[model samples]
Structures are given as C-alpha cells and as structure tokens.
Target: MPEVYHLIVNPAAGHGKAPEFVQNHVVPLLHHLGIAFELHETKGVRDAGRIGAEILTTTSFPVKVVIAGGDGTAHEMIEGVLKAERDKKDQALGRWELVILPLGTANALFSSLFPQPPEPPSEPSSLVSYLSDTGPDVLYQLSSLLASLKSTTPARRLPITLTSLESPISPPTEPIQSHIVLSTALHAAILSDSEALRSSYPGLERFKIAADQNLGVFFKADVRLIPPHSGKIKQYDPSVGNWVDPFTFGEDTLSGPFAYFLSTTTTPRLEPSFVISPLLATLPPNPSDPPTMDIIVLRPLRDPAVRSALASRGDEAASETWKSRIRQVMGWAYKGGGHVDLTYPAHRGETEVKGGGEVVVETFRCGGFEWVPTDAEHEPSHIVCADGSLHTIERNGKATVQVMDPGHDNSDDGFWVWA
Candidate 1:
C-alpha cells in the first residue's frame, strides 16, 4: 500500500559528486518507475535525519524513503527514521524500508552488500541488475543483515549501541549512542583522525593516510564478547565458511594492547578487498538474521616475533623497526590475515615468527561487546568510532554493543531496492 517514496538526497556527498548523479540519472529512473516521490535534499550533517523525520511524521502519504547518497547519508536517514518512529507513534509506520543509492566514497555497506564487479564503471543499473539477477539468493547470503533487523523488532525499542567517551565535564550518561559499523580501537581512531584530513584528501586516500598514522599505535583495553541472541559466541571455520559456536572462550575472551578491534552489524566486507568478516555474509549460522555484528580483532601478542619488546635504539634503528612493524601489519591485512597465522620472524632476517608463532588477530562473530579502556596510564583506548562518527570511551567505563533483531511472521516480507 505504501506506493509513495521519499527521496532523501545529500547534495554534498562524495565531496559534491552525488548531486550530479541524482539529477542526471536517479530522478529520471524514478519517473520511469511511475513512483510518487518527494525529494528532500540534505542541508547539513543531520539535515537528512531531520527532513526524513518530518516527511514520515507530518505527511499522511504511504511512503518509503530512498537514501540517495552514500553510507554516511544512509546512516543518517536510518537514525532519522528510527527517531521519528520512536517519538511519534501514530505516524510511525510498521516497517520503514530503506533503499540505498551508493553515491559516496567508501560506500562500505553498499559495496559489501553488493560487490562491484572486478572491472570499472560500476553504475546504478549494474547494481540494480545484480539485485534482480541474484533474486532471493542475495538475501540468503545476507541472512545476518535481514534477520538482525527483524530480531531487533526495531519497531519496538529500536535498540541503540552506545560508546561513551570520558571527558573532564561528564562522568557517564545513559544510552550513549548506537553504531552500525566499525566500533572499537583502531576503527575509531581512523575515523577520528580521518575527519581532519577529509578536506585535504576528500577520498579513500584520507582513510589510507589515517591508517598509516595509526598503524603503529595500539590500544589497551579488556573486551567482553557478548554472543548472538543465543547467548553464545560463534567462530568462523574457514574450511566450511560457517559460524560455529566456540564453547571455550567466554565473556572475557579478549584482553587488550590491541592493534585493530572493530565490529560490524550489517554489510560484511567493508571494501571488496577488505573482507573483514568474510564468513558473516557468505556463511552465517542463520540466514534470517542479517543485523548481527561481524567483529574483526587484531591482537599484538598473536604476532610470532612479539615474544619480547624490542628496545628503542638510534633514530635510524627506530625508524627501521617502525617500518618493519607497518609492513608486517599491512601484509596481514592484505593476505586475509584471519589473525590466526601471523608470525613475525624472530631470529636474524627471517620473516616467520620464532617457532611458527602465535595468532596475530583473533576474529569473532557476536551480537554485542563491551570495550573497557585502560585508565591507569594515558593509553590510546580513549577513542570509539560509531558509523564514521567519533566517540571516546570513558577510562574506567566500557562500551556495550548488542545486536537487535526485529522480526515478524511475515516470511513474504523484507526490504528491497526497486530497479
């Protein structure tokens, strides 16, 4: 019955590239579909949310909001819809569907959900064709994405995962903020640092720069892994490409001084090459739940050569050591480093860690987690990035993230983008 659709456009997305695409292509396509739409171009950061909230609540039209920007714009639209639904019960629709148009750089969610072909010229039609061609199989692959949404029954509480940062003014507040992608140590730092460089670089290069800057740093913290709805954590057995509950590790499976610790609720592969949670999208335990978080962790102790700390020497020696560390870390990321088989060559000039050593990264799949930063010392654990937005965790406090599944008996139902 909701034939009407609301178009939320971010004119400044992709550093001012989205508007042209929307004007040239998207609008014409909407006309061809014969769909009723009201376009709302975003003004500021939260403008999409504000505009979406307005259209959803004030208008009596049966509508779906199509987000016409990248991931950041999509995220803002979602937050806006949820907030409006939460505040205005009568206007809040039973199911608010989101149709994304990937118009930003690092459109992580869109890219992960629908991988661009290896070749170039990935256009809107190609994406639509992929969706229609794959049929339900795509849904089957993204079971976690769908099921997670249903399980949350977002129409109910609309769960929010908050990461609170400690500041001199405030202690800790209730219900901090929720994030869909990259929540934790390095992820937060990358986003936090990347903001300043966004203007100068304005593209993926900014992310690369941030990664280079933060690659050598590690955060000190203790992690508490909260399992899926079943109250149990799942591990990917690469051999089978499925999630298997690891019964041994419990709440405190992770201790920090970690290099990279990030989690994703939806959209498994951030970039095509960066298969952070290959198993989440490809082989999840349940296909019905797509909202579950795929957590990727990098622990330094897992490094083979890190048996002992290297003493700092002259400027040249320190620079060389730093270079080695960077290359090693970056290599692991490139080779699908499951964090299990990372070995830093110990003796002489060898590459393998002494004795074929420890697992450098410990990856996990779960509903939520709590990151408690080290306060005794001035550690790097003072940051948390939620959906490309930065937030820091309180020194003595923790950040708890749990996946919510908003489900219904309507097996015939789900959200999809119209071609």
Candidate 2:
C-alpha cells in the first residue's frame, strides 16, 4: 500500500452531506484498498491552495491527495501543488496527479469526468464504491496519460494570467488572481450581482437574477481571440457535427456591445443538467498543447429580427429576446443542442445570412484572451469571476486571462484522491 494525502474538505458541499458520506463510506473503502492517508480541512477562501502547497514542500514521500469537495476546492489544491514547486527544478515538478469528489451545487468538473446518467439520485455509498473500487485502473491509465502530458521543455514557473477589475475614476493597479477558474463579461457580472441574492436564490436562480439585472445592457468592448497552443480557433459547423477552423477573411477581431462571453479551465458542464461544453472530456489536453479553456459566447445583435428602426426598441426587445434565448440555450444544452440552427431572421420572417445574422454566438478555445471595455460611462464594464472569487473591472480598462500549467517538480509532491 502507498501513502496518500487528502487535501482540503469543505463540509458544506452538497448542502453539508459530503463530509458525512466521506466519513462513513470513503474512509472505510480507503482502508479496504490498503492505502495509507491523512485529511486536512480548509478554513477560508484560498486555504486549500496553501495547504496543498504546504504538503508538497514538507512531505517527503510518494503520496496521493484526495480532494473531497467541489471544483473550487480542487482548483485550490491544484494551484497549491503548482505553487509549492516554484522554487525547485523543472524535472521534479511534474509528479502529482489530481482526483476529485463532486460535492457542490454544480459539480461541473465531476460531471465532465463521469458522464451523467438519465436517472435519479443514488446514495453516496454507490458513488464511493465506484470511485474507490473501480477507479484504480483509471488512475493507472492516467499515470500514462500524464507522462505524455509532460512538457518537452525544462520546468519553469507556470505563470497564471489574472484579470484585474478597476473603477473608471481610479486608474487600474493590481491584477485579480486565480489558479483554475476565470471569467468576465456576462458570467462575471452575474456572479458579482448575484452574491447578494444567494440566500433567496440559493442555487442557480441567483444567476438568473443577475442576468435579468444586466440583460439589456450592451457591453461595448474590443475582443482579441487568440488560438490555442496547438490548434486554431475552432468553430462548430452544424453540418459536420465537429469543429472546423473558423473561416475568417482577415483578423479574428470581435467587436461588441455584446450580450455574453465567458470561459472555463477544466469542467465544461457547469451543473449536473447544464452540459455546456460537451467536447471537453472526449478531448482532454495533451502535453504538446496542454489542457486549456473553451470559451462560449452569445451575441444578440446577430439575430435577423434586429434593425436600426428597432434600435429604440432594442432594450425592450433585447430583454424579451434574451429571456427567450436563455431558455432556448438551456434547452439546447440539455439536448446536446449542437444542431440548433440559430439563423438571423430577415425582414418578413426570412431566415438568411445575406447581410449577416445577429444571434451569432462564437465559441473558441485559447491559451489566453483580452477584454477591454469602453470607458465613457460611470457604470463599470462588467465583473470578473475567478473560481467563485469575483472582481469588478475598473472604469476605462480591460481584463486579460491566460492559461498555463503550474510547475511542479522534485520539490516534493503529487495529488492523490481516494481510490
């Protein structure tokens, strides 16, 4: 049997059921598997990262760390592992692996790992059994997968790109920090405003309220779409059921008083039912490219119903249209709506892209991006969310984000979830 370290556990995940389930089921199963272990708890935001870093620095054995919470906790663990090895040589940092337990409102990361079944809630013991009894082989396979994921170059400090939000009156200064998650535009604003309504709208409804509050407001900004490390900007061709490189005539520039824009690092599906990024799991990141983010967007002006005369009616129409679009988007998400033909409507109800469509949403994969909002107004451009931590954009500024793996080497460590 090998020694393992379980990272921070948030007792409140899944409405406080995770800790009990782990104690009753996971512990005994780990014992049965003959794996030695230890457990740590998070005291506050970002604590998990610190704890994980500590383990990598102080511990001197081959250990596996199991994170018993949701994606945010796991994210911190990953960051901690990367941060711990910053001072060490590159050859030693690429050792640990990550494993997770899904115990949050939206266990997106777990859903990405294990596809959802069209059934009801099973007890935690069943899930525990599957992960502990049936998962070791997967871990062995991951060991091989990781070997291939290692960078061909020397180990270096994995630079994390942070997007800073600054107020317009004041000049922007510090950058917002994150390890796993990052967001801005609509998603960031929704999370920021929705925080106050969390108790009333305990789950996803907060997002709805935030959406409603910010709905008709057009965001004026310039977007620079960077391609992935090893691939081009891929756009889904409905006819092909696969991604093809976006056929742009010139520069891949996007302009807006746009509706939605957001990205994710690991998990594509945000919740159990919300299957937002379906292709993420089937194509995990490779060493040559590394695992990056899939950005999803919804631009309302691309709809054919849009017109200059309707410019005055834009706000009112946009609110209704946005509501309808959101519902449709959710439905499409449920049905794996890769085929939803979102055509711009022409005058007299014609569906065509003669001039262009208004509802054209763009999806892209990239190593990083830049979001520069217009600065002419008193209101902030939008909020930015990094793994649930929110930051408001400063007036007259932009937020930039880039993705890179944290460097971990001989310093001392690797992640191990219970198996």
lDDT by residue (1-419, candidate 2, tens digit) is 44574545777665776677567655665576555667787787778878877777766555455666776776666666665565555524444545466665555655654554443323234234444444443333232112212323232222244454555577664455454457666666777778889888878878778877876555667677766555666665444445667642247767765667777655657666565665554444454454356777666566544433247675677556565555555466665534133444545354332224433446666666777776557243556677777765666666777665343343323332221
Model 1: worst 10 consecutive residues (lDDT sum): 149-158
Which residue ranges in model 1 land beyond 4 Å of their true spot?
A: 59-63, 89-93, 118-180, 196-209, 237-242, 247-251, 289-291, 310-326, 335-358, 376-379, 407-419
Best by lDDT: 1
Q: lDDT for every model?
A: 0.59, 0.57
Model 1 agreement with the true structure over 64-148: per-residue lDDT tens digits: 5667677788667656766676577664344555656667655776665556544332223423553343335333323222322
